[model samples]
Target: MGTFRIEGGAPLKGEITPQGAKNEALQVLCTVLLTPEKVTITNIPDIIDVNKLIALLSNLGVKVQKLGHGAYSFQADEVNLSYIESEAFKKEGAALRGSIMIVGPLLARFGKGYIPKPGGDKIGRRRLDTHFEGFINLGAKFRYNEEDHFYGVEAERLKGTYMLLDEASVTGTANIVMAAVLAEGKTTIYNAACEPYLQQLCNMLNSMGAKITGVGSNLLEIEGVDSLGGCEHRILPDMIEIGSWIGLAAMTQSEITIKNVSWDNLGVIPSTFRKLGITLERRGDDIYIPAHTEGYEIQSYIDGSILTIADAPWPGFTPDLLSIVLVVATQARGSVLIHQKMFESRLFFTDRLIDMGAQIILCDPHRANVIGLGFKSKLRGILMSSPDIRAGISLLIAALSAKGVSIIQNGDQIDRGYERIDERLKAIGAKITRID
Candidate 1:
């Protein structure tokens, strides 16, 4: 196991050029399976999750080449989709929940797709029912045997139709979009997750000849094509990273410039955080965080001013980053009620904050009311192990801003999505060292 030992209360400075989005890189890499022609992806982050997806693709017989830094070329003359039942497949596939994403493309193109199970954050009861529902609606037959916990999908030809997803699951929406791109007719996906990742997927698919409209909205209109071709695409900067850095700068009272942030992709995140009394300045492609802003009070409703942060479907605050918001609120001067409606187990980590001397009330499984004691000035650094990717980074931000020293174990969780995290923080003057 690896750990991050950080001497806290060091203000982070300098500029950090954000890496390409890891979530987008997964879908773009998997899209190579949809065509025999080579597809080139630029600005891909060298992260753990992206590496695992590349390993999965290579196992399936895609020729993956690294063309020097952050660039790669992938071509699948013939994909060995049959070998997915091997022990190696199960071990690696279980390591990343994003492995579930390949199921739809495999089934649509090869008529059968097998996966033991998808692994990801244990935040809550994430439903694959929406994914299965989309495929079932597209005429794919599914069989699940609890003995092996493997899911098998086979279809002669996927006939596209209207699909009303049970929830706006991020990957669920992505899985169906991949399956529908080559189906027989138009696929009308209602209640879809139109996150920036999905938009990137759609843009890549469109460049590859799949006709898709409504790129950033909830309702997606995907018109099936006979097959897709190859095109070059660059993944966007990570929005979750943007959120994490914002929290980091505010908590440490650092003046940092985050470069190349896709301002348009942020949608409502800026406004959502502004409600928390965080100020940001947009200078070209960068967002600058000023130093030494006192904890501004959160704005409340018309009737009463009780601060609240809620995560909803896309165009709303992302549920994936509500943990970041919760962590940031711990140092603010006011109180905030964070509602994580989609996942039941996501809020369980509030106890860890309580351990770190944060005044948080876990109202329920999905809600936590945090009353910031106005920069408590004394966080007794403790040994804490990371639980998941986003939560792990949140803890790192918390650790970096604390008064004393902290040791964070299971650093691989943070490595899963973030690239060069320790080095990047160090470049910004954070006193962090990675140890094994």
Candidate 2:
């Protein structure tokens, strides 16, 4: 029930410190259930999703204490297993994709797990098959009603084995990994999503005395231990938000410095943006976007014509941030095709961009060709509804660069990942007003 009115045509300038990774922080926070000791976490993003997860954990009898800004200590020293079947637990479980992760640790440590239908970005059919299959391979009996959509898994001591996931679903991979950590033997996960988030999860597991190697790759080896101890782990920086901020800086011709970026982990992200001729500078762990950057040409061939930006699995461009990049691409000098292979409906929001006077070709559900009419074209803002998190942030970026004041309803969508986005943009001299 909130809206953001962004006046167009100002590139964000100033300093922004990216928050902890939303994806990784959630996974690590949930891992507290694996042990009965306090797990301290730093660099946690104070976003809505993280807050919701913390609430879920608290409701399940985990002690979450805020130590400082972006720092917290969680102790599930004695999780109340009976609350797992409570209505409040089911409602909270249905509130997030990451909530499903609780099942693995619960099943491993408490002998059973219960979860209701989960909720997240309604992009497409996100399945938990891979997660359940891993549990089943380790000897789990699960029964769920399709009509009521409740799930319960009664798992014995999970004995690790090789798991070839049907798809490299991010949450699915994390769930299985969490389950396998306290299993009886070795768990080999193939086609695993070893993105920086996943890597952080593995690191946290290692800190808890779990044996996990081959982090940051498609394959991972996890050697289960009898039990795990508490550990302190720092969540990685939010690269997706960093990338969004980078795109915002470039599109608005603003000079901004983004701090605490994990430069090494951002493999291929810089180059992927470089394809559009955006100049990216790395000063230690900070990323700076120089002002008045000449936007690049989305080149096609060696002759330097129009090209496209697409998403694939990791090592390829991330599908989640493609929407933000596509919006930024609209202000570039040339055209680029954006093929969003993972989701069918992500490109549908581009119609709002077209309404702003940007030239875009919507070729079916999965693809779009965006021709930047140049910044001089003057995109005039309009009233819009935010669709999802990334796409919602993309629309906010567009509104920021457009010619008039634009109102973005459903601004809370952007609040899911980016922390204090309005305050952050305001600090950078952006004309954004949040109204409820």
Per-residue lDDT of candidate 1, residues 88-152 (tens digit):
88888878888888898887788777787788888888768888888999999999979877888
Worst 10 residues of 1 by lDDT: 372-381
Write down the TM-score for model 1: 0.97
- In model 1, what is the error at residue 75, expressed in angstroms? 0.5
lDDT of 1 at 209: 92
RMSD of each: 1.4, 1.4
Candidate 2 colliding pairs: 11-252, 300-305, 308-337
lDDT of each: 0.86, 0.86
| Local accuracy of candidate 2 as per-residue lDDT tens digits, 336-396 | 8889898888788988989888888999898888888667687889999998889999999
Candidate 1: clashing residue pairs, number: 1
lDDT of 1 at 17: 86
**What CA RMSD would candidate 2 show?**
1.4
